[model samples]
Target: MKNFKEKFKLKLAENNYKFTRQREIIVETILENENWHFNAEDLFAAVKEKDSEIGMATIYRTLELLEKLDLIHILDFNDDSRVYELYLKDHHHHHLICKGCGKLVEFSDQGIDYFEKELEDKYDFSIDEHKLRFYGYCGDCRDK
Candidate 1:
């Protein structure tokens, strides 16, 4: 967590933005729930518990800044809400969406390499990153 704070500090310095207390609280809350994906309202609720003085607009702005800094990722699952997750290179993964209950599961595999290569060769395009999601019922929902 300390490492991420330092990284955030450096990113702020690089972008000529001062890291304020409200931003700190937002980042801290995000770091605390690193494994969980949340939208602005969910994040605001968690952060509000820590610092009631923080405002919703501050959370939104901080989320934008963090995403711009490439410190986090915003995911859309074809829903009205957007979810955010930590952008760690080591933890790169895709999502499996449960159509039954809207559950999201993280998955990683090397099989995408061959598929990516095929697309690149076919379209003569260079792909830097990819976001793939498979929609299906999760194990718990499958039996239901």
Candidate 2:
């Protein structure tokens, strides 16, 4: 928690932005709950518990700023809402989404990486980044 707070402070300072109490609460919430894939409304509710004066607009704007700074990732799964996760530096992976229960699983496979590299080489193009989401029924949903 301390490390996250320090990093947040540094990031704010580097960007010449002031570290407000609301921003601190938001950052702390995101850092502490690493597994939660939250939407802006959900995050607003969570942060409101810490500081009731924080508005939803503030949360949305803060999330956009954080995304711009590469501090978090914004995921769009063809759903009505967008989800966010903390950008775990140096940890690259894709998501396996359960369409039935809306559960998301993270996975990294060397075979996928090799395939991507080979495709890029064959096409004579440089692959910078990609987002792969496999949607299927989870085990529990399938059993049911």
Candidate 3:
């Protein structure tokens, strides 16, 4: 977490933004809940438990900054709201979303490299990144 904080501070400095206390609290909350797939509202709720003075505007702004700095990834599961995850390059994974209950599951990217390579060769294009999401009903919802 210290390493992430330092990197985030440096990135903020590079972008001419100050790493304020509110931002620090927000970042800390995010780092602490590394497995959480959250939106601004979710983040606001979590951050409020730590510092109630943090406003929704601040949360949104900090989220925007993090996304712009490539420190987080914004996921659009077509659910009318965005979710966020830390952008760990080495831990890249895709999502399996349950449309019935809005549950999100992360799955490994085992076979994706081969598919990406094939697509790159076929299209003669260099792929920098990709996002894959499969939406369906989870077991509980499917049985209903």
Largest lDDT belongs to which candidate?
3
Whole-model lDDT values for every prediction: 0.89, 0.85, 0.90
Candidate 2 clashes: the total is: 0
lDDT of 2 at 136: 98
Please give the RMSD to the true structure for each candidate, in Å: 1.8, 1.9, 1.4
In candidate 1, what are the lDDT values of residues 1-144, reduced to their tens digit? 788889999999999999899999898888888466878998999999999999999998999999999998889888888888888877768899999988888988888878899999999999989898999999989998
Q: Give the lowest summed-lDDT range of ten residues in model 1.
A: 30-39
Model 1 regions lying over 4 Å from their true place:
118-124
lDDT, candidate 3, 17-46, per-residue tens? 998999999999998885758888989999
Question: Could you give candidate 2's per-residue lDDT for residues 15-86 as a string of tens digits?
Answer: 998998888889988776767578888788888888999998899889988888777888989988898987
TM-score of model 1 vs. true structure: 0.88
Q: Which pairs clash inside model 3?
A: none
- Weakest lDDT window of 10 consecutive positions for candidate 3: 31-40
Q: Which ten residues in a row have the lowest lDDT in candidate 2?
A: 29-38
* TM-score per candidate: 0.88, 0.87, 0.92
The TM-score-based order of candidates, best leading, equals 3, 1, 2
